[model samples]
Target: MKLKITVLFIAFISSLTIAQTKVGTIDSEYIIGMMPETKKVVEITKSYGAMLDSTFSIRVTDFKVRLEDYKLKEKDMGELEKKTIQKELAGLEQDIKKYQKNGNTLMGLKRDELMRPLYTMLSEAIAFVAKENGYTQILTITGNEFAYIDSKFDITELVLKKLGITIPKG
Candidate 1:
């Protein structure tokens, strides 16, 4: 009958639509954590941070020592000498603040510089896995981007495997 043929055609079209859209979810944070390069980046950043801390500490100690010496000698010094020491101490304080601010900025830049390549590699692996598996879209689940996702749709392990990174066995 004409009605039966129309129903069958609609069902076929519905099936085709369902088959074309293959959505998968990936946890980028989880993937990045599993990478060995991440650990190395963290260690390198920590060492750099320690070096900055040491430099800042030395400067602070020098400032403290100079201030204490100035205080002890102030009673015996002329008014001009006291004013000059005060100005010098103020300048040292400003230098310390500037160094702290610049050190934070440098650390952020270094972290981005070191992590960019790793991120690019991860992105490539994800793309490759998506393409190979015929996935139309891969969504990140790391930041609660999706309210609900079936576990079967998660391709995180597949992505890790594609990158030659072994997933840690629980």
Candidate 2:
């Protein structure tokens, strides 16, 4: 009787362990990008790009008009006068280039600054969801990797929801 009971208990414990499913997979970038914070980050980047683009447009338009004015005066000007104007225009162009370079650097820094907070939040959310849902492991599927995962085992939607991402109804 004792042997039978011990065997039954071990079998039950093994069955319980076997009953728990282990699942993992890679999520599409498109799906991850739909997170609300990700959308906000994209919007911020677009706004910065638009500002830089408009600034460049205005500067180029002004420079073109200035260049035309200089060309019209070239016939009446001495060599020194023409050289001075050319130097000034060259300096202006250099300034514009510097501005663009600085804008790119600043935009990158700002984007990273903004993303840090969001990343921390997302990490916490993922942890919370993983713990609550008993997710033993969740793997990120990136490019050039084939993870053997069943589509039915994906918990991406649940994780997204835990991160406060709202799923749109089809």
Candidate 3:
């Protein structure tokens, strides 16, 4: 009789633990896209991209002008002088390529800088909503990696609500 009672107690505890686990999914990207403040971030990112593009364009223009000048003067230049100009032009060409690579990296960094705060805000709101709703785990849906997640378990709308956002009706 005592063994039976102990077994029942253990079974009850296990059931409680299993029942406490509540998993939910949220699409944070959708939440961020819906945010009005994202417009400002987009504008700033575009401006930064344009600045990088212009810098690249100026370097290309400078290289072309120098190449033209070198071509015009190459005939009158001495051996050593010609070699010096050639070396300088080669270095400038390499520098321009390096600038283009660096510009791409800088643009990515700037985008992260702009998006960090919005992600942070969404993270905090998600946490609050999860705790309030007794969620044991929250997953983010990206692409179609998830074979299938029941819509009833999606807490995205709840999270948006927590952040005082309303999902626009289709």
Candidate 4:
């Protein structure tokens, strides 16, 4: 009787472990970008990029005009004033180039800053959904890196549907 009881206990524990190991993978990028909140974030990102670009353009033109005026009067200015003007102009030029180079929504540090919170929220949501559905584990595999995931294991469709993403069929 004790041996049967021990076997049952061990079986129960094994099942519990198996249950907790429920795994799922998300095309996290797809999910995040699909959500409505992402649309707002994208607009914000675009606005920020435009603002940076306009600001940089104004600063560059303003600084260039000032530098030209300083150069025209360099002979009358003290060495200290000349050096200070050159340094300021150089700094402004650098700012213009840096802002221009980075003024794209696709490549800004703000992308990650905006995305991380969404990622965290997704993670929490995933955990909640998985527990409710008795999933034990979740994994994300990109197309480039994933060579062989069985179609049955590909829960992307199910997850997207569950998340209310109605992807159109091609």
lDDT of 4 by residue, 1-170 (tens): 99999999999999987766756666766777677778887888788777777877788789879888988999999999989988988888887777677666444678678777877877776776677667777677655476566655556666666667778778
Candidate 2 local accuracy as lDDT?
Answer: 0.78
Candidate 3 C-alpha lDDT tens digits along 14-67: 999999999999888999998877999999999999999999999999999999
Candidate numbers, best lDDT first, in rank order: 1, 3, 2, 4
**Which lDDT tens digits does candidate 2 get at residues 117-162?**
7767666766676677777776766574763667766667877777
Once fitted onto the true fold, the runs of candidate 3 whose alpha carbons sit more than 4 angstroms away are none
Q: Sorted by TM-score, highest first, which candidate order results?
A: 3, 1, 2, 4
Look at candidate 4 and tell me the lDDT of residue 68.
88
Instruction: Give the Cα-based TM-score of candidate 2 against the true structure.
Output: 0.69
Task: Pick the winner on lDDT between candidates 2 and 3.
Answer: 3
Please give the lDDT score for candidate 1: 0.94
Better of 2 and 4 by lDDT: 2
Candidate 4 runs further than 4 Å off: 1-20, 71-81, 91-113
Pairwise TM-score winner, candidates 2 and 4: 2
RMSD after CA superposition, every candidate: 2.3, 5.3, 1.6, 4.6
Highest TM-score among the candidates is held by which one?
3
Per-candidate TM vs. native?
0.87, 0.69, 0.91, 0.66
Give candidate 2 misplaced runs (Cα > 4 Å): 1-23, 26-32, 134-136
